[model samples]
Target chain A: MKETKKILLNSRPEGRPGDSNFKFETEQVSEPKEGEVLLKTEYVSVDPYLRGRMSDAKSYIPPFEVGKPISSLMVAEVLESKSDKLQKGDHVVGMLDWKERQVASAEELRKVDEDKAPLSAYLGILGMTGLTAYLGLTEIGKPKKGETMVVSGAAGAVGSTVGQIGKILGLKVIGIAGTDEKVEMIKNEFGFDEGINYNTTDNMTEAINKACPDGIDVYFDNVGGEISEAILFNINKFSRTVVCGAISVYNETSLPKSISVQPFLIKKSSMMQGFVISDYSDRHSEGVQQLAKWLQEGKLTYTETVREGFENIPQAFLDLFDGKNKGKMVVKV
Target chain B: MKETKKILLNSRPEGRPGDSNFKFETEQVSEPKEGEVLLKTEYVSVDPYLRGRMSDAKSYIPPFEVGKPISSLMVAEVLESKSDKLQKGDHVVGMLDWKERQVASAEELRKVDEDKAPLSAYLGILGMTGLTAYLGLTEIGKPKKGETMVVSGAAGAVGSTVGQIGKILGLKVIGIAGTDEKVEMIKNEFGFDEGINYNTTDNMTEAINKACPDGIDVYFDNVGGEISEAILFNINKFSRTVVCGAISVYNETSLPKSISVQPFLIKKSSMMQGFVISDYSDRHSEGVQQLAKWLQEGKLTYTETVREGFENIPQAFLDLFDGKNKGKMVVKV
Candidate 1:
């Protein structure tokens, strides 16, 4: 038997989660059953959506039960396999228990070839996050060449990938982030045409208009509320807005005050669509393959802000809401 | 020469338009020039969108100039014609000057065949207002059979048409109206599955839920603001919201306080689209032909709140904001 250290949800959080919300435990992992495989976690992804799952609320997916192992997207290596599809030493990515080791059925894990790109790429640019950005952009935000695309939280995993893909499609990409460094990284590293640090900007509408004088043709919204209202005012006629996340209003105790945008929407004849990555589960492989191809071609790049140890998982997850993570927040347990 | 009475915008209103904002003037009709025709206005359509055009602020259409004739969709007779496409006494429908009698270019008018429908029907059921409802429902709302479709301002022109179409498409159509009379009209006359009187309802959300137990799949919003926000909460996954109009917010001094629906949008993986009739200009003929066919088959019906005299045009237009119009408000000039 091998020892497995895991982080469990200690209690339901009302607002922002804290260290007290999680507890670490060690368990003995038994040998794999008929179709099961033992996985040694290489990297665990901590995303903004995990915060939603921590609370018992009606959402796209079910909530995490108190005292259960925190589940997340994990890139792992097969320690032992009893299935023909997966063998020992094979790298995989799947929804896995937040632990140093986990036992899951082989059907739950997708085998990954590390020879194409770095192993961590599966958790960032070529994983669910990347697929989300791709599907949201192509499926909803049908951006045209020379059109302007605006993305909020553009330094993070999904937003960063969306902006880069917009650039690849020959669109002028403008990004909004919380810090100057993230803005700079988006412009210099991710090839964004322009970036705005929402922290310093007094008027987001003016900043957006300044960055996108031709008017925003596609708005990839990650941070909703005031920023989204500002973008709505500047969008061109027949523009498409893709709502991937609303991190800004997630922690509010009461419903946030929103500016009435229906009038503007009517005038512009625009559309705003919201979607979860799972909505495109059937086409996820197509997205993954395209993103992987982009990654191998060096056309797309990703960054990870890895937190060390299973003990730091809660902190790493919390850092996402505070905009402390420069890229994808992941834990190395 | 024939006498022609016209109403012109005397000045731009600061807020809600009053009688003083318009001026009536009489002018002499001149002979038709080459490719021009003399027209006698029969029925003039009064809509809520005209209020937006009166202001200098940029909108979907150009602003109505001060001291100029307010253009509207009107059914008229060709008093004299210089173009071969039309002849004297031919009935026509076009964007014409709000005058009892005037000269219009042949290029601006389309001959209306009264054999298919009444000449006044060109300004209501088979006109821009009808097309607005038709395209907004089919293209934007995308209501599926057996889905619940909720439409606000249910007894008004666009809303009434939307509700009727919803029923024809095998949807359980629920309507929200201001008065009990209008509510009954929607349920009995328009064939809506149910109706909610927003004025009497203590909790609009509760009323909406009770009416649409299956949850709203399509929300045809004509009155935006709090009501629209409430509907957003009850929408099912992959629902579609068509923002046809926001009459409630049109005359506000400043932006109204709205509830944040972004979280719900993300949770439901839904879509909200705003459209102007002009956006479907390329498909105008398609919409008109289909609507005319429906009218002839008696599958669709329309009501006109006809306010007699050219002098009442301004008041008829303002009555739209007051929810006084039972269906399409038209002026007999």
Candidate 2:
């Protein structure tokens, strides 16, 4: 038997989640049975979407129950393998429990090459984050060349990747971020044509109007609140809005109200669509292949805010709400 | 020279439009120039969408300029033709001004077949009203046969037509209207599966949940305010919302606020799209053909509240805001 540390939900969050919402415990792990592999967790991905799972609300995916082990995308090292598909010492990735070590079925994990890309990347740019930005932009945004594309939460994992992809597609990409530093980073490092520091701007509507003189043709919305309401005014005819994530209002205890989008949509003949990554599961392999190609060609780059030690996982997740991370926030075990 | 009465927009409405906003005057009708036809207006269609044009705010179509003739879909008889395309007494339909008699270029008008359908039908079921309902529902709603479709403003022209088309397409249809009488009319006359009088219902969200037991798969939203917000709670995964019109808030002087739709849309992975009829101009003929076929097969029917006299046009338009008419509201001069 091997000793492992695990984190379970102590209680559901009310408005914003904190350390009290999570309970840490040391547990004993059993040996792998036939068709199972013993995985030592190497990287734990902490994302904003996990906040939705913490609530007992009806969503695309089932909410995580209280007093149960939280699970998410993680990269692990196969310490012992009883399956023929994966041998000992192989690096794999899958939706696994928030534990230091655990036994999982071999079919649940996919092997990752150490020489191709870093292991943590499988949880970010090469995994769900990349797939989401790619599929959501292409399938819904339907971005045409020469059209202007605006991205909200522009310094984060999905937003940064989406803006880069927009540039690759020959679009005039603009980003809206929380800080001036992030605004500069997106323009200088991410190759975005323009950037708006939403925190410093007094009137977001006027700022967006000034930034996008020709009007926004496609909008990748990650923060949905007042910023989104402002973007509505700048949308061009037949513009498409990809409603990816709403980090801004996720912590609100009550229903948030904003200017009605119906009038703007009707006037401009636009479309606003939302999607979970699993909705495009059939085309996931195609998305990964394209992302891999871009990474290999040096056309794609990613940033990671890695917090060391297994004990820091809960803090890492809480940090997302405070805008503490620049890109993908992950915990190294 | 011929004398004709014309109605001009005197001032833009502050909130709800009133008769005082319109001005009527006698003018001399000009003779037909080369390629022009002298048209004697017969049937005038007054719609809720006209309220949008009365404001100076930018919209899908240019706002009706104050102190200029207010124009809409009208059926007219050609008194004289200077073009080879039309003959005298040919009944035609087009976007014509509010004048008893006027001269228009023949190319701007399409001759309506009085023998196939009544001349007035050219302004309702076989015209923009029918086209708006059919195209908006199919193009955006994308209703599957077994799906449940909930329509707001279900007793109005586009909503009634949308609900019937939903039934013809094999969808379970539910409608929400203001009055109990209108609700009964939609169920009995329009053949909706269920009806909800929003004014009488205390909890619209619960009402919609009970009406759409399987949850709403397609929403034909004609009135976009609290009713549309209530529908957001009961939407199933991958549903589509066709934002056809927002008569409820069109006359509001300031921006209307409602519950933010982004969260609901994201949780359900649905789509909310708005469109103008002209966006599908390429498919206009196809829509008219299909609507005509459905009407001739007795698979479809229509209702019209025809108000008589040339002077009552402005009053007829004002009555739309009070929900005084059922289905199409037309003025016969």
Candidate 3:
């Protein structure tokens, strides 16, 4: 309780960032000011999007400062509260530092009901990741019953939720993942109609075509590369392609190459849209409530690949680009 | 007429096809069956989109069959009608063959009132081209007052109308064209706020940045290549890109390559949509009536590049790739 060990962005990665880019430093814990709470971190999220902030390039959100503590969604337990909104033992989620213990303003954290869902769910399935999946699919994909929906990064947290939502809406869901295990998880666990392991599929386009016999009406593209190129070919007329994340190109040192989409889009009169989750900041709770309801109804399933201890947070984050985790990749401290 | 002269698709184009791909043939005029009308072609449209139909590749519309008359929109004089819907001497527009004379069912053509607008206007402003511009802007662009709207192919039929409509909607309109003459016409005549000559501008992206001090809000992309790439860089958050046409790459035997738009679109949370005018088939009259009203009030002005004689139609169509014509290219037969 006296020491706060935080991960600092030591250096910007040239291509694929690893543990070398992060520095672990320990400091004395500070007292909570008025309207502030001292939180003991229980679970911290390591998302693919964090790779973008690791660079100094301009983006939807500013790049993380080189010397400052890397920040993301963390589920924590309030040990000391100077605010009336939260009390000791209250479980909450906040955009906090990658630290074992930290002080944050009461407004920075929101109380999470542990009785409704697990504490780690607030870092992923019932948090930003879930909202990202819901908003991108619902707002851009515009899912309709009986339509064929294809989602890339099918085994990831957002992709998993997207496929389940598609199924719940009566869509014939097909997912593209990287491994046989992920493929199996999508079909048997997430309730997708079919799954394509792009890593082993001889021809992704043919595999996708076989899975989606009726051409794809909605495509949630999370990995933008050859997989996206494959999806583009099987798109039906007026298909909606939702651009969520392109994890495939996140570590690329050069311009990412893929088949052009303009000609296909023009021929089919289709739409391709890209969005960041921050755009739906106003509708956060709507997604949370709906996701919780589905979870309570036993209609939605989620998987988490948790790495233990505060010292392993950097390795946990580095593992995301390596595709080492299933669903949400979180570190428990 | 006793004889009908037709332009036939001799062979599919192999990388920028020219007049050699067309064959002119003469045949005796056939009689109109019951519920049909015999028509004499007065004005036939030669649009850039026709270049798409010249190939056997799949698209929203069917390819022009070889050894047969190439089909497109034409304004003709109804010489005789056996149906109750039409009478002799009525001027009508319909998707008919590229011939001096032909017979079509009464339901295939809709008579146009020449008193409201010029007969040729039906092929340019008050026709499908104008509708492409209108619907693309109204439905997709969704222009707002005081926002920036940049349109490529600015002097062409659709681009010109898009810019003028942008002006009417109280938007800051910037046009991109091939020639200095077109750049001047878009500004002086069409009332565009500014114009960028892609032919003369060393850097289209820089030129666009200079023309648009405020980032682009809506981009009506008719020529999608480097120009589209340039527009992508300057897009503001939530910007809408209306993919009206990709004339720049229509003739390429290979896939078109430009900068990848995925990253930029993701960062800006923007949308890119491709649509064919025929998608609004049920709402055709709505667009036609609105365009007609704008023409009557002098709110819209159009320029047509007309070539006399059906024999010159092949060359007129070929010249589109060369950027020879100013506005809508039409043949007066």
TM-score, one value per model? 0.97, 0.99, 0.98
Tens-digit lDDT track of model 2 for B33-135: 9999999999999998899899888888899999999999999999999999999999999999999999999999999899888888888889998999999
With a 3 Å backbone cut-off (N, CA, C), the pairs that clash in candidate 1 are none
lDDT of each: 0.89, 0.94, 0.90
Q: Once model 3 is optimally superposed onto the true structure by TM-score, how far is the C-alpha of residue A225 displaced, in angstroms? A: 1.5
lDDT of 1 by residue, B151-185 (tens): 99899988999999888899999999999999999
Q: Please, what's the RMSD in Å of model 1?
A: 1.5
Model 3 clashing residue pairs (backbone): none
CA-based DockQ, model 3:
0.65
Fnat of candidate 2 is 0.94
Winner on DockQ (1 vs 2): 2
- Model 2, TM vs. native: 0.99
Sorting all predicted structures by TM-score, with the top scorer first, yields: 2, 3, 1
Q: Which stretches of candidate 1 lie over 4 Å from their true place?
A: A1-3, B1-3
